[model samples]
Target: MKGTAILFQADQSVTFIEDIEHSVYEEIKSQCGCEHCNCKIENKIVDFGTVSPVFWHEDEIDWDYGY
Candidate 1:
């Protein structure tokens, strides 16, 4: 219900072929839309890579898709 919105894009084919299919993110939060989101990012980190490690709060990510 609350978290961050990391905006980025990537080239899947290139990344996959080059075996460079991973990044190092020093920051991450929830994935839900910013709904009254009180996200408090004290010191957001932007590391190398094309937005590889976009983590979430819980151990597992929650993609609430309308399936």
Candidate 2:
């Protein structure tokens, strides 16, 4: 069965959580600043019979600067 998920970031950490509730895609699209911000939430496709959901960063992280 298809459901909804929420991918949000906070406290310098990113999280992807799955739920049957509302979709957070618009919320993330509206709040995402890519290179400058991290507090956002998005909807991801989840399939229980196939593969699990994974988190992906929009930009590459610079380990040296830790941004």
Candidate 3:
């Protein structure tokens, strides 16, 4: 399970959103502790919206092994 996290800046407040499949919304919501699943905009309609791309990688690594 790997994805990206995006942050949006608005006039009043800042919002965080992610670009991923709808099926994974639950997992992302839980992790981000976001009140809503989708991005909230005050006015105007946006096509791609104000989403900054973030790269995420999930892999199993041995932490016990010293660097």
Question: Could you give candidate 3's per-residue lDDT for residues 29-62 as a string of tens digits?
Answer: 3434333334323343323322332223233334
Tens-digit lDDT string for candidate 1 (1-67):
3332433323331111111112212222232232222222334433223433243232223448531
What tens digits encode model 2's per-residue C-alpha lDDT throughout 1-67?
A: 2233334443344444443323243433444544333223334442222112223443234449853
Clashing pairs in 1: none
Which residue pairs clash within candidate 2? none
lDDT of 2: 0.36
Q: Where does candidate 1 have its weakest 10-residue lDDT segment?
A: 13-22
Candidate 1 regions exceeding 4 Å error are 1-3, 11-41, 48-62
> Model-by-model lDDT, in order?
0.28, 0.36, 0.36
Candidate 1 to truth, TM: 0.18
Model 2 segments more than 4 A misplaced: 1-12, 20-23, 34-67
For model 3, the local distance difference test gives: 0.36
